[model samples]
Target: MNYCVVGTNNMTASQGFYNALFAQAGLQTVLPSERMTYWIGDDFAFATAEPFDKKPATHGNGTMVGFSVGSKEEVKKLHGLALRLGGRCEGAPHQRGPKFSAYVRDLDDNKLCFSD
Candidate 1:
């Protein structure tokens, strides 16, 4: 997919969370507006936005965004960093099938996975 977006009720908190997370992950911010913020990497893009319908943004029950961060070490690093940045752990880093992965829920409770 070209990109994926998660909904956030609090834009300021979401932006702060993602800005620090993406900065360490090497994703660059582009095309930011008051309601939406995007981070782009070489092959993919991720974004967070306030709902366009003017209702409160809520996390989808089964939806998640995953990032392939290249190595188990990086996955672990990001998992730890995310916790330090206020994300909650869904799962700790470990090998799952052929990939090493970890899971976290952002400040808005949006799920994310980091895999290697």
Candidate 2:
């Protein structure tokens, strides 16, 4: 897929979370707005939006979004940056066979993984 999106209850704060989080892989915002913003990477787009019905956004129990980067060091650095930017650590950087990965929850509780 070329794009992915997750819901947010607090658009402002969630935007901040994604802004700092995606920068680790050098993604840049292609579209920015109060209700939604889309960040474009070399091969994909990622985004966040407030609920259209005005209900509080909630995380799916087992859903996750993953970003694959160029190297293990980038995975580690992004994971650390996520934590420093208010994301919660779900898993620290570690290698499992061919993949080195780290997991984190965005400011709005959306699960995400950084992998290499």
Clashes in each model (backbone N, CA, C under 3 Å)? Answer: 0, 0
Clashing pairs in 2: none
For model 1 the local lDDT of residue 46 reads 91
Candidate 2 global TM-score: 0.90
List per-prediction Cα lDDT, in the order shown.
Answer: 0.91, 0.85
TM-score of each: 0.95, 0.90
Candidate 1 residue pairs in backbone clash? none
The superposed Cα distance between candidate 2 and the true structure at residue 100, in angstroms, equals 0.5
In model 1, the number of clashes is 0
